[model samples]
Every structure is written in C-alpha cells, then in structure tokens.
Target: MPGVDHCLQEAMAIPGAVGASIVDYTTGFPVATTGAAPNSDHEAAAAGTADVIQAANSRSLFVSAMPHDLLEDLIITTAGGYHLLRMVQTEFDSRLVLYVWLDRVQGNLAVARRRMQKLADELVAT
Candidate 1:
C-alpha cells in the first residue's frame, strides 16, 4: 500500500492538479502536501479544509437519512478552480481528508473526483 506522501504524489498526477494534501480534519493539520497551495500558503489551506469538513459534519443539512451513511466527499467550485475533498475511511474512526486543487479551465471534475476517491482508499489500505 502507498503511504501518505505517495498518495499525494499520485493525486498531483491528475490532470490540471495544482496542489494536493492529506489533512487531519480533527486538528486542521496537514500530514502531507505537494505542489502550490492557494495563496501559496499550505497551512491556511489545510485549516480552511478542516473547517469546511467540520461544518459539513456538524450540520444536518448535508447528512443522509439512510442507515450508516456517512459523508464521502465534497467539491467546491470557484470561478478559477475546483476544490476536491475526499474522506479517508479506515478501520477505526478516520479523520483524514484528501484535498486537491485543480484549474477549472483544464481539469475534468469527473475524472478528478473519481481518482481522488481511489487515492483516498489507497491511503488507508494496509
């Protein structure tokens, strides 16, 4: 199985990927990161990611009614780029978030989303 750093490197390989990071949502700390972050600040980007995740999880507006259903992913699109966030589900309670930024003009949201899902799975694979 690939480690966290490798997972991020693979994420960066996705077309139009500007940056990628594996963040601990619980603490808003980045475990690993690659490429350029928004505003050239990975620390701020990671914290913002965690805040978004925390809000999504805390609010009922985004939750599903189905039994055992959990939030799997989130996508935020801006005029210039896209922000993709995938949850890393593990055997234990997982607090990891795989985040990637892609240029809107060159990136395919469908492909990035799919690849991110796969990468997130690899992060927890033993």
Candidate 2:
C-alpha cells in the first residue's frame, strides 16, 4: 500500500499534471502535496477547493435522489487547465479529496479522471 507521499508522486506522474495534493476538506488543509501549485500558494488553493466541495455537498442540486448515492468526483475546467477533485472514500466519516491540476492543452481529461479514480480507490488500503 502507498502512503500519502507515494500516492502524490503517482498522481504527479500523470501526463500534464501541474500539481497534486491530498486535502482535508473539512478543514481546508492540505495533507500532502507535490509539484507546482496555483498562484504558487497551496494553502489558498486547498481552502478554495474545500469551499467548492462544501458547497456541493450542502446543495440539494448536487445531491441525488438515491439515498445511498454519494458525491464521487468533480472536474472544473478553466481556460488554462483542468482542476480535478476526487472524493476519497474511507471506512469512516473523514472528509478528504484528492486534487490534481493539469494543463488543458496537454492533459487528457479521460485519462486523468480514470487515473484519479484508481488512486483514490487504492488509498483505502493504506
């Protein structure tokens, strides 16, 4: 099983990955990080990520009609790149997210999403 640092390294290995981090959405704090961050500020980026997640979780529009359904991931596209957020599903109630930033022109959204899903799935084994 991979630890946080190793998981992040794997995340950065993805094509066009600009930055990657594991964040505690509940506190808007970064648990681990690698590569370049937006605005050269990982803290701000994490907080902003948390805010977006909090909004989605709280809003009924984002919710599903199925009682067992849960939010899995979110992809936000920008003029410069793609912001990917994969909710880490743990055995407990802890709120966590795997965040990845990729260059829009160089990154393959389909590939990145698939890789993020795999990474998130493995985290539970740690």
Candidate 3:
C-alpha cells in the first residue's frame, strides 16, 4: 500500500507528467506534492480545481435523473497540456484528489487515466 508521498512519486513517473499532487478538496490544501510549479504554487491549483469539483458534485445532488455514476474525475485539456484530477476514495474523513499535469504532446491520456485509477485504488490513508 502506498502512502501519500509514494503515490505522488508514482503519479509523477507517468509519461509526460509535469507535476503531481494530492490535495484535500474541502480545504484546497495539498497534502503532498512533487514537480509542482516554480514555487510549489500547487495551493492555488488545488483551490481552483476544488471549486470545479465542488460544482460538479453539487449538480449531482439536485439532478435526480443523473446517472448513478454521479461525479468522477475531472479533466481539462489545453493546447499545451492536460490537467487530470482523480478523486481518491478513502475510509477516513479527508476528501482527496490526485492532480497531475502532463505535456500534451508527450502524454498518453488513456494510459495516464488508467494509471491514475490504479494509483487511487492502491492508496492507503494513514
């Protein structure tokens, strides 16, 4: 079972990964990070992404017709790269997300997503 740091390192090992972090969506705080921006400004990214996740989560509440799937990870694709967010399912109280930044030209989206899912499953909160 991987801890936060180990999981983050694994995330960054993905092909074309620019940076990776585990964030607490509720507080917009990163629990662990690597390859983060110049000054480790992942805090801002966490806060921003958390808002997006929250919005999607909120929609699932009022929309009865919504599929049983409700909300899953969020992905944003830009001309330069891809931003992938995988929500971690844990037994504890923390609502965590795995955030990965990848180079658009080098990253394989399908592979990245699959690996992220595996990483999420392997996580064991401590």
lDDT of each: 0.91, 0.92, 0.83
Ranking of predictions according to lDDT: 2, 1, 3
In model 3, the worst 10-residue window by lDDT is 62-71
Instruction: State TM-scores per candidate.
Output: 0.94, 0.95, 0.87
On TM-score, the leading prediction is 2
Candidate 3 per-residue C-alpha lDDT over 1-126 given as tens digits, one digit per residue, 9 for 90 to 100 = 677889889999999999998888888887888896424588888788788778767755653355676455888998989999998988778788889999999999999999999999889644
* Model 2 Cα shift for residue 18 (angstroms): 0.5
Find the 10 residues in a row with the least total lDDT in model 1. 59-68
lDDT for each residue of candidate 1 in 1-126, tens digit (9 for 90 to 100) = 688888889999999999999899989998899999999999899999999999888776646657677899999999999999999898897588899999999899999999999988877776
**RMSD of each predicted structure:** 1.2, 1.2, 2.7
Against the true structure, whose lDDT is highest?
A: 2
Kindly provide the TM-score of model 1 when superposed on the true structure, using C-alpha atoms: 0.94
Model 2: per-residue Cα lDDT over 48-120, one tens digit each: 9999998888875756657868889999999999999999999988899999999999999999999999998
Q: Look at candidate 3 and tell me the lDDT of residue 57.
A: 79
Clash statistics: count for each candidate: 0, 0, 0
Off by over 4 Å in 1: none
